[model samples]
Target: MNTRQIIIIALLIIALVIPGSSLLGEKEYPKFLEEPWDHSPITVYIDEQNTPPHYSPSYQPTVIRALQYWEKGGNGKLSYNPVFELANTSDADIYIMWVENMEEVTGAEEGVAGFCRPMIANGRYVHADIVLEVGDYKGYSWQQYGDDNMEQLVTHELGHALGLGHSNDIRDIMYPTYEQRENLNPLLVQTTYPLIVISILIAIGISGYLGVGWLRYHKRRKRLENELLKEMK
Candidate 1:
């Protein structure tokens, strides 16, 4: 009816036209295979010989801890259980190796934390090799970064080996950068939780508004019918 009212109606129409989910910056986790591993144990071998001398036997425990973290922290969504083994390189399904430089695995000169290369056959991931560049954090002692940070790094590479691509969300373990945090942020862990709750509330409110409008329309119609009958009488 007026300029302000017309502007409000136009804004409402625009809001209706836009997709609500698009407001949130959520992206899909790039998957490696169509179906995930059905809770089967994936044999992992920590390459003792090939690992850098500075990160030898001491780093082995870190790798084992990292594997354990994956199994317990994945919340069953990871699908595969990581089984650490003393098998030879050829017998193992997954290999974890440490490298002084990641320029070979990743084409970067610096700050390349780790890399995962998965072998695929018949559209299924067969095996994977993970390489962690300890030299990335040169000055930091193994004790300093080894405990929590190393576990996080291995978890990230293992995520890729399990057929997940890097997530844009830094809070996710699948993120390209290896954050030195103890655990993943809450948002990445449950991206849709808030969205789902908001959607339900909006749905309830819309239903209530529609119900009130229907009742008002019915009451007005009944009142008009009675008035018409009285006039006729």
Candidate 2:
């Protein structure tokens, strides 16, 4: 072959070999877990003095269930203090001001379910307001109403209040769409099976690329030595 043809063939060989070699032994690679975020403990205070939908008896239990779900699902050790007595000094960081009227809730756009504003404490505190409607739960609207439905809404909103964004997984509590009021499922945990598989594939691709390059170098060196011995003989 001419010089140009030989050069072109060599480039083609490298292009095909590089990607092909990366796929070898990819199924048997080690995987790594990503570290969780470092977040401070959030305290939730129910406004005791508030009347009607705000300070109902069932409200406290629903909030507690939501907090417990976060502690287990997030794998986070979070301390929750639900207070009715108005102490001058409170340890809670996120104070939930429950409002009876839907108009009081901020960021309630035409189609949005709820609104959240980050309350900064020394430029670090994150807080928000949670509003509940008395007769709104039975209808088809997303606003929470009854005890069961209210628990579902509280679980979803508190997730946002705790610095969690909406998850795409329908099974996850953090998902934007509202299902029923259910406990956090193990399958929908942040560290899902797909992440493990992707991490393994990346590690294998890297290791195989290095291994194949070393093998090719040794094979070429041995061929060169054999050619030199034939010339000498």
Candidate 3:
């Protein structure tokens, strides 16, 4: 064959051989994935002693709402309680100590909104710094703004405190950007239908391969037996 034709024939042979060689190879992808969390129940205690007076009205309720939403949707378990004395002892899995002043906590700066910092040594508790603007009220700010501004913002920050990363989905509550109450999106449930279908297809393919292999084995054995019998005759 000419040079061009010979190169074309070699390319076709390589393409066919590569796929068959891959089928004989033992590489496999993992079928199951582990859930992110350790599945342990987390109890959170809000430090009432150091919490600012301005945040008293919206503080506890906003935290409770956020916790409820997380517990209901996520696989991990969480519980919360307001505490007066946790100064000397660490009891809960997560201690949410609210500081009256932002300057008291290291590595915490006043963000455009609220600020949160996790205790690295303990890694279980997170301290939140609440600084109210000149005109912001404790209880009335959430009520006046509704979901338009503060409630979702606090909820989003609290989610970070609870070990949740931002979701890329705009429709999920964990989205990086915050929306107003009327515009807020609820968390969506993850579905297993796609995974189930893919698993079934894999099973079908494996079964078909085994069946074809068994049939070919029997045909080869029968041909070898007839040849031996003819030689004996």
lDDT of 2 by residue, 112-165 (tens): 333334454433334455544433333555444567766777777666555444
Top of the candidates by TM-score: 1
Pick by lDDT: 1 or 3, better one: 1
Alpha carbon lDDT at 177, candidate 3: 62
How many collisions per candidate? Answer: 1, 2, 2
Better-scoring candidate (TM-score), 2 or 3: 2
Give the runs in model 1 whose Cα sits over 4 Å from its true position.
1-27, 34-39, 73-86, 104-109, 137-145, 179-233
After the best TM-score superposition of candidate 3, give how far the Cα of residue 18 lies from its true spot, in angstroms: 20
Over 1-233, each residue of candidate 1 has an lDDT whose tens digit, in order, gives 57885675556545543554443333344444424343357778888776564564666777776677666755233534555455666557788888765654456545567777767666565777887876554556332245567777888887766655556676777767753221222222233333444444444444444455555555555665564444333
Superior candidate under TM-score, 1 versus 3: 1
- Candidate 1 minimal-lDDT segment of 10 residues: 180-189
**How does model 1 score by TM-score?**
0.55
Give the per-residue lDDT of model 3 (tens digit) for 78-143: 223222222333455445544343333332332323433334233233233323221123443422
Displacement of residue 8 (Cα, Å) in model 3 is: 16
**Of the candidates shown, which would achieve the greatest lDDT relative to the real structure?**
1
lDDT of 2: 0.47
Looking at candidate 3, what is the lDDT of residue 86? 23
